[model samples]
Target: MHASREPASRSVVSDVVADCLADIDRIAREYLLEVQKIDDYAGSAVVAQDLEETAVASMELLLRLVGNLPIPDRLAGVSEALGHRRAQQGLPLESLLRAVRMDFRILWTAMLEKVPAEFLPDFTQDAVRVWEAVEFHTIRVHAGYLNELATMAQEKETQRAFLLSRLINSEGKDPQLLGQAARALGVKPESSFIVAVAAGHAQKAFRAGVLRAGVGQFLHERDGALILILEDVPARARREPEGTRAWLAALDCFVAPPARSLAAVPPMLRIALESLPVVTPDRPGQRTVRDAWGYVAATRLGEYGTVLADTVLGPLATISAHERDRLIDTVQAYLRSGSVSETAAELYCHRNTVLNRLARFEQLTSFDPANPQDAATVIAALHVHFLRR
Candidate 1:
């Protein structure tokens, strides 16, 4: 009686396995249709194939496990492979797992239909085994997905850095290579772009703000500054002075005018770098060379502006730095006010003190503040001097 029952049990399991295999094609189709209804699986033929194979392989594994046969190595391999494929296809892991759960539900429902009520207890136990195998397969697939995500993130960062370097330093780089880099960075080679150099410490915050504002931008850190290339950036996207003063209070930003091509970026970046010293802390954001004649002069003169400052302000050099700053401040106030009383009022000093400072400045520089011609030259020299300082 025991031998006869053993054969009968084996036959029942074999018939169950046969029924599962027969439903494999229909189950796969159903799974695909359900997934498609949730989201378009277009351009994902490879992913679909892997998922289908995984479904078929899962059923086979269930058959073998219930039959007391050895599990195939290909089962684990296919599970991991499907996970990696889904990850590469940029499918959300949750969605992938949900689809897997759906496949299991479909297979389990079919298995219930094939087993008789008398054998329902045994069949339910075998179904539990199949569910356990599904869970195990999910673990392997999830591990593979995580690993692929990490690797893909690393590769993307590496590519970003490489492309940024090419864009920042275009010397000897072929036009073709520059175009490729531009495309990778998501900017057209011929598109008008603005290059900005900002304080490196503010890079992450600045980038977050730019992206949040929906501006297309690429950024890289170089020499303690963050260099950014903004593609067709809207006027409103440019950092506003009041906003910068209120929020990114410590940052210094220099923006260049729109450039016609990627090749123009380095020159524009150079102008921004040269204009850095002219940017005052009080005027914290986004200074353009075109906004001020003084900025343009300072950028054009480069280090020569420092030499010019030294030559023009040489007479004041002999004085103590403290007295020098005081005299310079008075000169600035006098130039801005154009009247001794106004200058004194602005400085909260007596009018005699303003007059005396002006006299002393004239004696040191031989450019009298009282005369229009002399005042013009002195004011221009002061701009260059203070800009460099």
Candidate 2:
């Protein structure tokens, strides 16, 4: 009889409980569907955690609706859940705000079936304020994350640049790295090579340009020296006139402090390196470009030949090496043996001494003193000594 009397209250309780059950099912399904979409967007297996968290959130709301907690407590729980989800995503405030707004729209549509129409406005307004707080904190986290990433990128670039500079300046000097650097810099590495060494301490820049222009090859500079590797020329450049022109152009345009001297490898390289004018006393002046090359060629030959000659002649002679050299001049004057007196007069030498040196030369060479062939051989030897030294 007592249970029958409270039927209206009992029916109202049953209806409310059923509505809450249905609301829980709807929220769970919606949360699952939304989480799947987010997971697809994130493209990471980590998104599964966020999906589980969302499922937990829907369960919490369901418990709240069923009176497992007081209204205020339930609202706090929902706020905490939303904050956790936003933090997990590392989303900015604006993005979280947008997401929260969407959540409210969905919840409002679902609650319309159970919650009083008059209560909807107040509920949405309260939930939005809580979501705004969550958004603000999450945005700060997102901004910090972005700043860290930017700093990392800047540091990486700086490290890369330093390594590249060190590689360029290294002394071991890898050929591949040099070729790659030349390619990157738009310079040709393969070309006829030449070296123009500038003198004086202050004219380094002038030296650089001269060396670069003269070589027409990739230029690599070091302290007081520039090493040029010509990529264009083959292992041999015997007698190329065009190659010579290019070498000259380089010397003419770039060298400063005026290169006192230039040298190249391979004896035949002069076929190219020689075309360039030497640094004259007037530098590009001196109407007669008299082959200064003879001097260079002679000097190089003398380096080796002098050793051989010194071994044979000893240090002593009728006079000093210089005087002996002067006496040798008589050979040119005696082209046809005009007369010993004439040669002596030309050389300012004594007649008997000239005859004695001729006798000594014939003895050493095992040739007859008076023979024409012996005279010619003596002249040829003298000529080589003169030209090489």
- For lDDT, the strongest prediction is 1
Q: Which ranges of candidate 2 are over 4 A from the true structure?
A: 1-175, 189-195, 199-220, 226-241, 246-307, 320-323, 328-389
lDDT per residue (tens digit) for residues 13-106 in model 1: 6687687777777766766676665463544544656656666776666555555567777774776777787888888888778766665677
Clashing pairs in 1: none
CA-RMSD of model 2: 19.4
Deviation (Å) of 232 in candidate 1? 3.4
- Which pairs of residues have clashing backbones in candidate 2? 190-231, 190-232, 191-231, 191-232, 209-254, 210-254, 210-255, 213-250, 214-250, 298-388
| Every model's TM-score | 0.70, 0.27
Model 2 has an lDDT value of 0.44
- lDDT agreement of model 1 with the native: 0.69
